[model samples]
Target: GRRIRKGAKMTYTTTYHSPLGIITLASDGEYLTGLWFNDQKYFGSTLTHNSIDKELPIFIQTKAWLDIYFNGEIPTFLPPLRYNTTVFREMVWNILLTIPYGTVITYKDIAQEIAKQTGQKSMSAQAIGGAVGHNPISLIIPCHRVVGTSGSLTGYAGGLNRKNELLQREKVNMTNLFVPSKKNL
Candidate 1:
């Protein structure tokens, strides 16, 4: 176990060797705050304010969960998560948790769900994309499970290649899922 310091506060950190890439996990010594592919978009954005130690208990537990997950075994439960964000983003993350393992959902579908939950007439998929793209925690929260309405792999902060790798690992049927055309090829 690593000691924090004489007076410095504790910040937990650890790494997971995922099939897709190395993943960094961080916590406030309690709830997991972030998990991302080493170079994923918005990586570590949530824990930049604190110093880190790699031997925290939360980090150990998260690594264990990742171990089971990457072995193609469904994690019996989610690791503890804690984040500070807007209410809508929190709601989006909660909806993400409801997405079953090895299945995919569309951004439009998430938007519709949010709209239904909030009693709104409708919600914008673009708005949902913004929330999803900014998700600080990656795999544990299952952001990669979201796809585009036309079966396009729209956006994954961890890179599309890693997203595909994760889906394949989970045995998700990708028969119709395809990367979308950006401008040309």
Candidate 2:
């Protein structure tokens, strides 16, 4: 298979009408590159010159997945993701796939899981948080499932309020969900 070139920048943006509001979907040629809430503040500067064919298969798949998700169905479609990030960030993103629908995990939990997988005890939660913050694909990667150490809502690139709404829409009752105080490493 021909891989999309690393650092070969491209972008396209479109608005999705959802219960939350108009979500702007951005993409590189090969993958979904961004999902932003209409009122999100930090996303303005993140826009770039990368332009892709909106009619590409990956873009179409992403739109279909979003349609299923918003229509009260579990999103079963997982499209290929093309992200430009560090090796560690890629590893962290792969780990995100193991988190099932309607479930949530804390940043600290992610750190411990990655540490166990790599046998690197020094890998900090802060580092994992950085990788998560850099997630280019949004709902498909389910970055909204991650929370703070206190089991409270944390900052989401898409906006914390949107994150809460996503969790709620998925029927994840954060109030009753168990968050361990001790790291699982």
Candidate 3:
């Protein structure tokens, strides 16, 4: 969930018609605060302050970026993304950014990367999962590119179907990407 300090910041929001569905883009007039699929997990977390306007410059830039992305062509660069979160989540998000356009990584792999980055003997994949799962910015940060230890298309806050679609759009080979037969309770 997101926390908003009284009179300290203003969150602006807008909707974009994405190939997957309507996506809500939130910003604090400069840096992007959050992006969420319609009805997705944590859809409006911390979105307490808001002014709905489609013409916000950030929204326009983000839409253009997404247009290029959904068309199967990577944008020349990512739009400005500004989010405030804990250090561990920030590290996980940075690692997610390095996942490449069409490649996927396991939670275990991310945990190992975090360990290497933080100089720890070991890290927990589940801890990495907690960070990745709560990523405020989804596609731009490439959280959908993470999978399970077995290459299974596992938990995605944006839903597994959307995750699969995004991967296919990015040209990830789904032949090796399977789903767990049993759902996690």
* Over 4 Å off, model 1: 1-10
Q: TM-score, each model?
A: 0.91, 0.80, 0.92
Of candidate 2, the 10-residue stretch with the lowest lDDT total is 176-185
**For candidate 1, lDDT tens digit of each residue in 122-172?**
999999999999999898888999999888887899998888888999999
RMSD of each: 3.2, 5.1, 3.9
In terms of lDDT, the poorest run of 10 residues in model 3 is 46-55
Error of 3 at 74 (Å): 0.7
Name model 3 segments beyond 4 Å from true.
1-7, 183-185
Error of 2 at 106 (Å): 1.1
Report the lDDT tens digits of candidate 3 across residue range 1-185: 45667676677888989989999998887778789997899786747654666468788899898899988998887778887889999999999988889999999999998999899999999899999999988899999999998888888999888898899889898888976667552
- Superposed Cα deviation of residue 71, candidate 2 (Å): 1.4
Where model 2 places Cα greater than 4 Å from the true spot, the runs are 1-8, 41-47, 50-53, 176-185
Can you give the lDDT of residue 135 in candidate 1?
Answer: 91
- lDDT against the true structure, each candidate: 0.87, 0.75, 0.87
